[model samples]
Target chain A: QKEVEQDPGPLSVPEGAIVSLNCTYSNSAFQYFMWYRQYSRKGPELLMYTYSSGNKEDGRFTAQVDKSSKYISLFIRDSQPSDSATYLCATGSNAGNNRKLIWGLGTSLAVNP
Target chain B: GAGVSQSPRYKVAKRGQDVALRCDPISGHVSLFWYQQALGQGPEFLTYFQNEAQLDKSGLPSDRFFAERPEGSVSTLKIQRTQQEDSAVYLCASSFRRGAPYNEQFFGPGTRLTVL
Candidate 1:
């Protein structure tokens, strides 16, 4: 099985709607979960990061991790056209040599105004 | 550079040609990383450096892929005899801490490499 799996979603939603993106993993050792947003022609910008299992909120974005189910999610409130981009999920067990990052295929999201 | 910086923003190379991508990390950052992102995929870890010491390079796909941080601040990833399969965006990232739990990697505007 792929270490991390995410549906590359070209998901479209009306502006102001709530959006949820998700990913699942097989590795039980991942202690850190992160969400990144990427625009075409740009590097991914870190949106939110969560350690262990819980929810971390940053303004319009919320990241939640369920270690029990090996699943993680990112929720966007009041989504906007500017929020249209690809969302990627990544996880790692350590830093430095532990810098190994398992990634899923990013989900493409379009918030139409 | 104030933020992590990458050069050439875009590069197109003929297959079998060599290519070098550069990155300037945030000043004094202790850790540097290289990642490869194929279309529609998340960035995959390629290698990492702690200051001038390379700690892990196992993520490199093959011998043609090499990265170095000579002065412990700036880094470069070189692809020798690049192949069409090597076409992807090469991203560089840096973090402030030396160890565990502080690995929040601040990224550069990656260099998109296309091998034709």
Candidate 2:
């Protein structure tokens, strides 16, 4: 099984719709969960970050992590066309003395007007 | 102010060629990272550099892959004798972390490499 699994979505939604993107991981060693948004041909940008199991909210975006189920989510409230991008979920663990990052295949999202 | 800048935003090379991708990180960032993003997939970790030293490179795929951040400000990832499988977008990121405050990596506009 992949260390991190996210649906390869080409999810289409109307503007102002609430968007929920999720990911599941098999590695319990994973501690930090993060969400990144990538526009076409651009590199992934940091969107939300959370540690362990809890929820963190920033403006219109909310990130949730469930360590017990090894699940993580990024919720976009009142989404916009600008939110039409790939949403990638990634994790990191301190294996040795530094960081070991693991990533999932991103979910491609398109919010139309 | 520049966020992060990568040189030669697009590169095309024949198989067995060598290519160098460059990254100029944000000033004063302590940690740098390299990742490979194949089509339709998220970025995969390639290596990490902290200051002038490369602390962990276990994620690097093979001997053909190498990265260096000699001055601790700019980093370059070099791929030697590249194969067709090496065609992917290479991304660079830098962060400020002492022992791990927050791994909120700031990424550059990647260098897309295509090998034919």
Candidate 3:
């Protein structure tokens, strides 16, 4: 199984709708969970970051991590057309001395007006 | 202020050709990273550099792939005898902090390489 698995979705939603994106991982050593947004032809930008097994809120976006289940989620409340982009989940662990991150395939989202 | 800049935004080369990609990181950033992003997939780590030192390069797919940050500010990823499978978007990122506990990385637009 892949270390990280995310549904490569082209999820379409209306503006102001609540959008939920999730990812699952098989590694237990992953301690930091992060969310990134990437526009077409642009590099990924960090959106939300969390290090615990609870929910973290930042304005209209919330990120949740469940270490017990090896699951992570990003929730967009009252989405906007600008939110139409690819969402990627990234995890990092201190395996030995390396600190590179493991990334998911990313979920493509489109919020229409 | 510039975030991160990568040269040769798009490149096309025939198989067995050698190509060099360049990255100019944000000034004074302590860490630099290289990642390969395949179509429809997220970026995968290729190598990491701390200043002029290469701490870890185990993620490099093969010996033909080499990266160097000689002055610790600009980096170059050189692929020798490139294969069709080497075609992908190469991304460069830089962070202000080290140790990688939770420093946010600033990424460049990336260089897309197509091998024929």
Best by TM-score: 3
> What C-alpha RMSD separates each model from the true structure?
1.4, 1.1, 1.0
In model 2, the Cα lDDT at residue B15 comes to: 94
lDDT of 3 by residue, A44-70 (tens): 999999988999999999999999999
- The residue pairs in collision within model 3 are none
Ranking by TM-score: 3, 2, 1
- The CA lDDT at A99 in model 3 is 62
Model 2: per-residue Cα lDDT over B3-103, one tens digit each: 98999999999999999999999999999999999999989888998899999898899999999999999999999999999999999999887588358
Which residue pairs come into collision in candidate 2?
A: none
- Per-residue lDDT for B45-111 in model 1, tens only? 8998999988999889999999999999999999999999999999999988777683588889899
- Model 1 residue runs over 4 Å out of place are none
Q: lDDT values of the candidates? A: 0.90, 0.92, 0.93
Candidate 2 is scored at a TM of 0.97
Higher TM-score: candidate 1 or 3?
Answer: 3
Which candidate leads the pack in lDDT? 3
Isolated chain B TM-score per model: 0.97, 0.97, 0.97
Worst 10 residues of 3 chain B by lDDT: B96-105
Evaluate residue B84 in candidate 3 and report its C-alpha lDDT on the 0 to 100 scale: 95
Report how far off residue B57 is in candidate 1 (Å).
0.5
